[model samples]
Target: MATPRPARAARVLLPALVAAALLGGCSTTVTGTAAPDPAPRPTEGVGADPVAWGDQVCGALLSYYQPLSARPDYAGADLPGIKDRLSGYLGNVRTGIDTGKQQLADAGASPVSGGDQFRTSIEDLLNRTGTTIDEARADVDQADPNDVPGFQERLQAAEEKLRTIGAAEGLDQLGATPRLDKAIAEAPRCGELDALTAPS
Candidate 1:
């Protein structure tokens, strides 16, 4: 008996189609165009744009210092009143620490040489201040109206701590970093920061 024509064609065409499909599956799709290269990261020694970095740093600092800018006066308040104001003040400082940490992190690594060290020191300072503030708040919470002298003393101590808790230290750090100092001086946002913290 003669081989069926359709069967013979199927044997021939099936393998060819399978092979073509397999090859197509293995082939990569082409767009006839090359993709753009990614941007290069700054090298270890290389710094970021000084003015831009300064702007970021100053902006972050400003936000960090905002909560403490205007302190609540507890001048004539009695023990309970004083405690309330003091607690509120310490709470603001705590909030400032939280705000500042986020801002600093958002500011990212310093672009100038030795900037990282300055950033680290500032962060450490903030952390320490936060711990101190927490302790002060606890003291305020536990203060006894019966012990007038002790309560006043604690309040005085907390006020002293607040006086030292503002943005001067961060400015001093900037001064230590000469390049950053210059950059910050040139940064417009830093100018706003200066005005905000300036003696009124």
Candidate 2:
């Protein structure tokens, strides 16, 4: 071991070092920082931002409805603004689901069960959000977005499902927190219907 220190060949070493330098910027090269976004990473794509959308919708709902809650007769006053915002946000998220579908395809993946979970959950969200928008619009059109307990229940369920999907990576790995979170939000929303309004 002491006799053989091994020879350093600059001939081999220079080319290896040059090769590393060359490949560093090569198309086929990989780096620790960038593993490549096999599927485009974006909110409307794989990084669906439904939870943020829900939170915004909730904030809007709470802003409009809470005041209306105290004065049911004046509920129609808050209709136009809430309806416009809700419709726009829901429309945007619907587009997001469509974008996500394309992303899955681009990633060389098919519509699997996990994708179904995300799809179904988002579709449910779209429906419920649409219902809220309708309820809000009904306030402007026929009536007001007043004490509609049933609509609230649907909205809350949609919110919960969105949260679950947001917290979990996807459907297949929807673990305890996601499920429990959904349960917690959903149960209370459903129960509120019984005591609040009979509008179903």
Candidate 3:
């Protein structure tokens, strides 16, 4: 089946949505001047070494979306080519999530309170998102030309669910820590994903 063309919004927003989930709801605000070579600066948040840890995790996720943001057209001129590209895109997203999970574990960054719960929640969320992306890719691959609308509906629904989860977890509130927030804002690649996806 031929894959349906995505709307302008979807084309722009999809990468940002995935990037946000991978960042554990980190803010997309870019502030200050990014260092020519910004290393993760140490930050003191609710947990031990939360800043450094968050930086590492968020950085990894953002890096994945950075290249996508640079692409003028995620969907190429050919429909079949677009489907193939999307398959590769989903695979990359899944790999990034897996790598981010490993980085989080290795960094041992946990909140001061409910550390285990927090870590579990994050891991579960990442895993679920990866699974959903896999499903979306399958749907894309198998979609008939007439099935494009349905596929789009399902994809949007999945994205909405992810947004709800992030909000419920107060990911945007991570900016409460001024220093950490600043660090995140100043990170060179922090807002790149969102910038590309945001509506003009």
For model 1 the TM-score comes to: 0.60
lDDT of 3 by residue, 150-186 (tens): 6455445545543432211434323223344454444
In model 2, pairs of residues that clash are 139-143, 139-144
For each candidate, what is the lDDT?
Answer: 0.53, 0.31, 0.45
- Model 3, C-alpha of 152: deviation from truth (Å): 8.2
lDDT of 1 by residue, 63-161 (tens): 545655545555566667756765776687688778877766766666665456555665776676677678767866777777987766665555444
Best by lDDT: 1
Q: How does model 2 score by TM-score?
A: 0.27
Off by over 4 Å in 3: 1-12, 15-51, 67-76, 111-121, 144-200
Q: 9 in model 2: Cα distance from truth in Å?
A: 53
Which digits, one per residue and each the tens of the lDDT, describe model 2 over residues 16-48?
Answer: 322322222001111123222233224453224
Candidate 3 residue pairs in clash (backbone atoms < 3 Å): none
Model 2, residue 73: displacement in angstroms? 24
lDDT of 2 at 183: 25
Worst 10 residues of 2 by lDDT: 1-10
Q: Predictions ranked by TM-score, top down?
A: 1, 3, 2
TM-score, per-candidate, Cα-based: 0.60, 0.27, 0.50
Worst 10-residue lDDT window, candidate 1: 1-10
Q: Which residue pairs collide in model 1, if any?
A: none
Stretches > 4 Å off in candidate 1: 1-48, 157-179, 196-200
